[model samples]
Target: MDHLLGEVRAAGGVARVASLRARGHSRRTIENAVSSRALTRPRNGWVAMPGADPLLVAAARAGVVLTCHTQARRLGLWVLEERPVHVAAPPHRHVGEVKRDTHVHWARPLVPRHPDALVDPIENVLVIAAACLPREEALTIWEAALRLELVERWSFERMPLPSSARDVLAECSSHSDSGLETLIPVRLRFLRLPIRQQVWLAGHPVDFLIGDRLVLQIDGGHHVGAQRRSDIAHDARLTLMGFHVIRIDYVQVVTRWPEVHDVIVRAIAQGLHRAA
Candidate 1:
């Protein structure tokens, strides 16, 4: 039993006790380890010790595609909400089989699917999670996803998402975050903003371009620590390159959109006047 526990810890500190039992570990031995604090039971049949990420252990025990906000965070995709475990299984699968603490979604399979599609990629899971998140949070996750290239524009367009998803996508179109950055083009159209969604100027990708004069930046707060310093340096460089830059926080784009609109309009006017 100690040998089994040692092996589990070496392999990332989590293992299914049931799997161990199947492999011939005695039930009494497993229970003894649990009682001795060598293993901590997070869910039925699953245990983790000091070395494993509990979330990963939980996901492994469920035996389905771990998804939504949970998977998004795991894959380093930007996530706006901290949800409990979100797992997606086939429609035919019984939800009762899942542990009580998990939030399970039985979804229709995504189409044109490859073998890899059985598991929700970080991008698809985030799109689903974003649909459930607050509009602002969804936008941040979207922008971050785009910057990271986790999702592509065409892939988002092609998804057979529900109406609820479409509504979220429309809201996310104008918002920016790594979570759903792929939807920026769609969002800009919804807002009727006559600006390029992503344009390269002065060697950095600017979020929105209102002609050659004005550049709009969508600042995702998570990146703020390092990004704030980078933004300061980039703004100085843009000033030298003869482009007027206007920056907006993720909150402003979702909550105070009118203010963001007004700021952009004023900046564009100033930029045009200066150019002339």
Candidate 2:
């Protein structure tokens, strides 16, 4: 059993219990380790160390395209909302019978070859992720995938998508946002404010731009502690450069869109009026 544990650890920190069993680990040994809390069952056939992230374990077990929020987080994408675990299985595989909490979507007529391939030779998880994620979340994943070079833009372009999915991708391609950033732009657009999405300022990225001077920041919960402090310092630096910075939190962006819009509109009007 100790030898089996070493083998599992060497295989990227995850392995299927069935694989271990096939490799000569006794059922009694498996049960004992699981009972001792030395191992955890992330999915039906997969088991890992107690501290392993469940998402990674599941992806490793499925042996197919594990993506969307799962891949985004794995690739270190800045994701705001937690989404269901999405996996793309081969067309003939009976993923539906797996009966796990994950949302498994089967892909019929698989692509000839995935563009942004993984080191493990898995199909382009990024493309599957982009297809399944919400429009806003997809955009965030797409940008992160590009920055990491995990997948190419052509991979997404090449997939055969339903009309609705294609439309969502088209609209989202022009704007990059997680859920929080998406809210800010949607609110600004509804209020008829001239705002640009993902505008770069002084080497830092701002969520929206109101003309040349005002930068809009959407602060999600993840932006706390050291990150929060860094953001404050960046805002101060922008202020020193004669730029106005308006920051809003997730609650303001989600529940108080009108109030948020009014505040930004007033600020923009004031800035423009002063410039005039």
Candidate 3:
């Protein structure tokens, strides 16, 4: 009925027939609803209310569940790359049709997945991402997951992680302000420099304070308007106080990484990341 359509809409306009039945709609009611054009059976066991998420519908048709970076991005978790539809299937199940630009995973899942799930479990997604992505890149996503409480730190600790993955998690700080904040540590970790995060200075919390007097301010896409002006004022105050501030945006931190690296290296050579 009306409640059923609302549920369907809430569930991205599509749901498993079994789920509808479990929600107290009788089998006959479901059939009648479909017959009355109130719901449409998109697949053998799935019903959709007019317009479901096209991506999810396509994934369902392909019999592949979204996983790794793809699922992370969809869940609003931190992900460096966005292209290529990443999907996963159990080792025994046949995945979707082979196509260019489609990244399919056939590895056994670290966590159990429901038979009809259209998306991989969050833990599974992180595990796969940790193993597949560069250690530093993976750290941001894991840290973001931890910050959002989407996944518990203990859960990752309980999972069997390789030495490399363990190292990444060990450095994952829940205190990171954003994915870019997490990236600062990972990218600069190899330098063995003393780094502090979320440091309080002049009545504002800066993203990172490196060594002694250097601060890093990471700005995400929405870091504009009053916040941006306030940050600029803070930077001026910090500079006047003999603190070096390096402010960068998402693209400079995530995409133009080498440029960021060179800047950091030169700043270190100039002793900018240290006390005067």
**TM-scores, one per candidate:** 0.58, 0.57, 0.85
How does model 3 fare in lDDT?
A: 0.81
CA shift of 92, model 2, Å: 3.3
Residue-level lDDT of model 1, residues 1-276, one tens digit each, is: 777787677646766666677778888888888899888775676677755775555555565667777776766766654667778777786533566777877766453223222247655575566656666556666656665777776677677777655565555543343443443444445445466666777778887776666777778755577778988898899888888887777687556767876775576555551453
Model 1: residues with Cα > 4 Å off, grouped in runs? 10-13, 21-29, 41-44, 50-66, 82-85, 92-103, 108-127, 130-187, 191-194, 197-207, 218-242, 250-256, 266-276
Instruction: Give lDDT: candidate 1, residue 83.
Output: 67
- Candidate 2, residues 46-163, lDDT tens digits: the string is 6687666555565655555555566667667767577666666666764323336777667542354231121122224545554665555565555555555565556756867665
The predicted structure with the larger lDDT, 1 or 3, is 3
Clashes of 2: 1
lDDT for model 2, on a 0 to 1 scale? 0.63
Clashes of each: 17, 1, 0
Model number with the top lDDT: 3
Model 3: how far residue 124 lies from native, Å = 0.7
User: How much does candidate 1 score in TM-score?
Assistant: 0.58
Q: Write the per-residue lDDT of candidate 3 for residues 109-221, one digit (tens) a residue.
A: 87888755789888888877878888766887888888888988887798886665677778788678777787788778887898888889999998888899888888877
